[model samples]
Target: MNGTSDVPDRPRRQCPGCMRTLVVDEQNFHKDSLCADGFTRRCSDCRNEAERIRYSLEAPQRARAKRERRAERRAYFESIGRYEAA
Candidate 1:
């Protein structure tokens, strides 16, 4: 008789961030993350953040707008002699 038959079957997966063992069908398997439907495994947090950033309006454009607003404010302050150089 072969002893290999006694071994139970275990799902195989690897974490995207750490490349660690990620058991399939487990709670940590596909909770949240951008993972390929095929064989790729990605951490939940990483995936969620990516999705959030992608869908959020606070992207690089927002940052640029903020910078422009600040520049406008600084120019106003300078014109009023309220700007102090440190």
Candidate 2:
């Protein structure tokens, strides 16, 4: 993932779960994690853990975020209304 030639290369690591060797380059800004397929993917175990956590929190978290964004937009529009009237 390190497109820049200056970086030497990513060090390879063996995945404990899959038993596959994969190269992970910390210098690459684009990839969060590298899999054995040389594709960007979270480790299997980590992905499963994240999914479990996400399922538990997704509903309320999403609702609160949406509500906050809507409130922000309403406030911004209200603030601009007086200027537009003049």
Candidate 3:
């Protein structure tokens, strides 16, 4: 028999968010240009869940920030002598 182990040397990565060992591929992970390997650290499932939680928990703050930005833009436009209706 050959000395080589039966297990194939497949690319694999652990999802830090979920602690799941998933194959490193486009189907199991999302691509991110900023990452070292051009893929997100968390698997797609975990990433989606994190996004869902973050959006829900920060909804109020997010809305407030959006409103503040809009107000600032309106003020800037008015300062430039281009008044806009709210």
Candidate 4:
């Protein structure tokens, strides 16, 4: 023996989000963020979809937050008598 372990390789995994059979390899899986496993649970396509949906749902809130921040900055400048009316 060349000193390699005799354990069999793991079988392919099914993506929980898409139900697609996938080979968990460097080319397919991403580094897991939750630290439960070494690879991500969902496939790339599923991950992208999830991100897209999340952004779409939160877009309005994000835009509103940005506008509020800008308004607050303008108010602060005005209070300091440095803001010019436009």
Candidate 5:
């Protein structure tokens, strides 16, 4: 026997971010239209971790930018005499 019977019929996938092999299935991957396999290259966990880290690093900057935009809008409204005290 070639011993290939031990493996499952479904293809196995490797996550690029973590380089861990896992069976290809909906639970293990996020569907993506761009990929040939119709799934993301990195597993959901890796992608989520990356997004979490990025959000943590940029949250302060994003908050500051949002505040600046609000200030700009308020100034514009005040200059146009449309400001209402809130």
Candidate 6:
């Protein structure tokens, strides 16, 4: 027999964030970030929400970094006198 028969199937689990009962399947859950388990603790909805919140919190930092990069590029081009004003 193959190794697939050696391991038992996992049971369905409830999402901690939303309390939604979810079958522990490949399409449903993601790989755990900490690598502590077969899949992530939160469901897709919770994961998406968390990502949205994190991005919202970091929006200002991202904007600042973008502006800095643009300024640096403009400065470099101006110093080289290779770029014209647009």
Candidate No. with top TM-score: 5
The regions of model 6 sitting more than 4 angstroms off are 1-10, 32-37
The ten-residue window of minimal lDDT in model 4 covers 26-35
What TM-score would each prediction reach against the true structure? 0.36, 0.38, 0.64, 0.73, 0.78, 0.71
Give the whole-model CA lDDT for all candidates, comma-separated: 0.70, 0.61, 0.93, 0.85, 0.91, 0.86
Ranking by TM-score: 5, 4, 6, 3, 2, 1
Q: Assess candidate 3 and give its TM-score to the true structure.
A: 0.64
lDDT of 4 by residue, 1-86 (tens): 89888997765789898899888875667778575667888888888888999999999999999999999999999999999998
lDDT preference between candidates 1 and 2, better one: 1
Model 6, 1-86: lDDT tens per residue?
A: 56467667767889999999888866667877575667898888899889999999999999999999999999999999988998
Output the better candidate (5/6) by TM-score: 5
Q: How accurate is candidate 1 locally (lDDT)?
A: 0.70
| lDDT score at residue 20, model 1, on the 0-100 scale | 72
Summarize candidate 1's per-residue lDDT along 54-83 as a digit string, tens digits. 868568788899999999999999999999
How much is 50 displaced in model 3, in angstroms? 0.7
- Candidate 1 global TM-score: 0.36
* TM-score computed on alpha carbons, candidate 6: 0.71
Tell me model 5's lDDT, rounded to 2 decimals.
0.91
Q: Summarize candidate 5's per-residue lDDT along 1-86 as a digit string, tens digits.
A: 97668765888889988999987778888889898989888888998899999999999999999999999999999999999998
Superposed Cα RMSD, model 6: 4.8
State residue 58's C-alpha deviation in candidate 6, in Å.
1.7
**What is the C-alpha RMSD, rounded to one decimal, of candidate 3?**
3.9
The C-alpha RMSD of each candidate to the native structure, in angstroms, is 9.0, 10.5, 3.9, 3.5, 3.8, 4.8
Runs in model 4 deviating more than 4 A are 1-11
Return the lDDT, model 5, position 85. Answer: 92
Candidates, ranked, lDDT: 3, 5, 6, 4, 1, 2
